[model samples]
Target chain A: GIQVEQSPPDLILQEGANSTLRCNFSDSVNNLQWFHQNPWGQLINLFYIPSGTKQNGRLSATTVATERYSLLYISSSQTTDSGVYFCAVVNGNKLVFGAGTILRVKS
Target chain B: GEEVAQTPKHLVRGEGQKAKLYCAPIKGHSYVFWYQQVLKNEFKFLISFQNENVFDETGMPKERFSAKCLPNSPCSLEIQATKLEDSAVYFCASSPQTGGTGNTIYFGEGSWLTVV
Candidate 1:
């Protein structure tokens, strides 16, 4: 099994601030995904970047597969962005998730 | 847009009772997975099926947790003699197929179970 670790386990910022979250995997992975669990407990897919970079709205993610690491960038944070961010990677047949980074945005 | 549908948004049961959760994967998806998240914490992989066939269940409890996927029907995850620790939000997800170099999966809203 592969071990996934997330950094800055907890983060807090003002609405207009910016932040970056990181994920590191112990082994090679075929699939990688970023998820946002909202206040209501709904898990929303943020990105499916196995490699390279992707952007959606104010959020962006970059995966360096060779380095076995990924970075998620949140710009101009908003109150709606307050939640837990999870980074998961496929290890063999099942996906293993990280401990997650809890982010809070103050209005 | 594709989505996984989970039934019974919330469930409450006794410690010794049985709890069953259902998930309907998106059309044409062949891989279904079940994961349990306790109090918005770490995700514990339970089981997965590749079109009615168990693909990998290494993380499953094996004794008290069982799951099944049938043709044209929703997949079901059943917990027998559930314990207080079994209370969590169960998430279901589906991908187009297995063994692909890059596969993107879609997850359901999740079913929250409360065991007293």
Candidate 2:
């Protein structure tokens, strides 16, 4: 089993602001995914970076496997981005999730 | 285009009653996973199935939680004699057999279960 810890348990930002959320894992992982749980409880997959950098629209993520850390960056945040961001790592056969970083983007 | 379909967006059941939830993985996916999210906490993996066989079920409560994935049928998770703690959002996800960065896992909208 792998332990995942997400930093900045809570964050508040004004629209157009930028934020960076971090996830630290205890062991090496084969699968890593970033998910956004919207206000309505939909777990939207944001990125699936295991050990590289990837960008999708206003969101981007980088995972350094050797460092055992991952970072999620959101630029020009919008009200729709207000929600909980989760980092899940697959260790062995199951995926373990982090506590999540709650973001509040005020418009 | 790729989506995991879950049934019963919301469910309410009395204590000690049985609760069942169903999930249909994407057409080409071979792996299905079930997770439970309580409040705003991290999701807890309950079970995972590779095709029609159970791959892992380490997080399931041996006494009350059981799941099945039969060929040509939707996967199902059943909780018997549910308790108050059983109330949470159940999420179903799917990925390909050769999972990695290339094969990203997708999740369903989740089913909200309230046990009173």
Candidate 3:
């Protein structure tokens, strides 16, 4: 089994600010994904970066597979980004998830 | 469809009752997975199927939990004699076959189950 740990278990920020969330895995993984669980309880895919970097709108993610760590950056954050951010890695055929980072952005 | 479609966004069951959730994976995706998320925030894998055959079910409970993905039908997760601890959000996901690499997977909106 693989273990995934997310940093800064909880976060609060004013709207328009920036933040970075991190995930570290205990073992090698071939698939890594970042997800945002909105207030409505929807798991939205933010990025699928097993390695390298990718950006979509105000969010970007980088995965250093060799280091077994991944970083998710939110630029000019919005209140809509408020929720739990989860990083998960495929362990065999299942996705092993981190405890998640809760983000709350104030107006 | 481009997204995984799960039925009955929310369900309520009493202890000892049965609960079932359904999921239709994105069209053309051959692999389907199920995961459970408790309010405490940890997501646990439950089971998976490739086409109509079970793939990996190491995370499923010893009893009362079962799942299936048959041809031309939506995948299903069934819980028998539900307990209070069975309350959680169940997520269904799918991925294109990527050999053994276990590539990217997309998740549905999740079915929220509450047991009383």
Interface RMSD of each: 1.8, 2.2, 2.4
Query: Every model's DockQ, to 2 decimals?
Result: 0.71, 0.63, 0.65
Q: Best candidate per DockQ, number?
A: 1
Q: Extract clashing residue pairs from model 2.
A: none
Candidate topping lDDT: 1
lDDT of 2 by residue, A3-78 (tens): 9999999999999999999999999898899999999999999998998999999999999999999999999999
Candidate 1, residues B1-116: lDDT per residue as tens digits? Answer: 36899998999999999999999999998899999999898999888889999988887998999999999789999999999999999999998888223788889999999999
How does candidate 1 score on lDDT?
Answer: 0.93
The TM-scores of all predictions, comma-separated, are: 0.97, 0.97, 0.97
Tens digit per residue, CA lDDT, model 2, B1-116: 36899988999999999999999999988889999999968699998888988888888998999999898898999999999999999999989885333478889999999999
Across residues B52-111, which tens digit of lDDT does each residue of candidate 3 receive? 899888889959999999898999999999999999999999999852255678899999
Number of residue pairs clashing in candidate 2, backbone atoms closer than 3 angstroms, sequence gap of 3 or more or interchain: 0
10 residues in a row with least lDDT, candidate 1 chain B: B97-106
TM-score top scorer: 1
Can you tell me which runs of candidate 2 are displaced by over 4 Å? B99-102
Docking class of 3: medium
> What 10-residue stretch in candidate 3 chain A is worst by lDDT?
A88-97
